[model samples]
Target: MESTMQLLNKALSVQRAAAWVEDMNLSKSAISMAQKRGRLSPVLAGNLAIKLGENPEHWIAVAALEAEPESELLTRLRKAANSWRKL
Candidate 1:
């Protein structure tokens, strides 16, 4: 699964990402922060997924998974997300 930052980078150029951040009412540094950290907040991830015409819940799960340390639940959630994507 791609990280939320990766997804956003693939979908938007630097200028467009800035514009999107502004449009979303996020701080000017929001995208930059996410890029530096290599992840986005779950809310932002879901909203970006919506903007990209994807399932918000799936991307939100992706974001949440990225934020967590590896564990059994994380493994299960990743499997679930992958299965959902197949549907």
Candidate 2:
């Protein structure tokens, strides 16, 4: 099962996770389960990326901004964006 950290890493957008759940297709309770349960939802995070039509690696980069809205996430995101472009 994918850990919460893994989901956070992949989605790059914690907001997307919240949104995905709010979309009525999923639920926060489900997310909580995925997070709290004994790794049954390992694929849930990856599934979220697929459902969002996003690349898994980039998903966390996209969501990282939301993950840390008040601090260095933005600066780090900028640097990561520059780095990503170079690659």
Candidate 3:
């Protein structure tokens, strides 16, 4: 049987997560672009939280997602979405 985390993984693939970022008017490539290039914008990051049924207000550093932040103020808000976390 699949472990709880494994089952969850199936529902949220890299593509799925990328699509989530794209839905916020960003690139699907943000997933890798964040690491290769830089961090993501605050709006995109916050929208990502909502896509995952999370609260942006309490959002933590997810560690595997990104988008070009819209402003300098949001530059510090760039953090991964935890897609990098695995056992």
Best-matching candidate per lDDT: 1
The number of residue pairs in model 3 that clash at the backbone is: 10
TM-score of each candidate structure, all chains considered together: 0.77, 0.37, 0.38
lDDT of 1 by residue, 1-87 (tens): 367877787658534866886788988888889888889889989988887778889788778889998899888878877766655
**For candidate 2, lDDT tens digit of each residue in 24-68?**
377567666655542324345446667656455554444443344
- Which candidate would rank higher by TM-score, 1 or 2? 1
Comparing candidate 2 with candidate 3, which one achieves the higher TM-score?
A: 3
| Ranking of models by lDDT | 1, 2, 3
Q: After superposition, how far is residue 86 of candidate 1 from its true place, in Å?
A: 3.5
**On a 0 to 1 TM-score scale, where does candidate 3 land against the true structure?**
0.38
Q: Which portions of model 1 show Cα errors greater than 4 Å?
A: 76-81
lDDT of 3 by residue, 1-87 (tens): 112222224325534755655556656675455445434345544455566665544333332222333665445443332233331
Off by over 4 Å in 3: 1-18, 37-40, 60-87
**lDDT measured at residue 57 in model 3 versus the true structure, 0 to 100:** 41
Per-residue lDDT value at 85 in model 1: 61
Looking at model 2, the pairs that clash are: 1-42, 2-42, 11-59, 11-60, 12-59, 12-60, 12-63, 12-64, 13-63
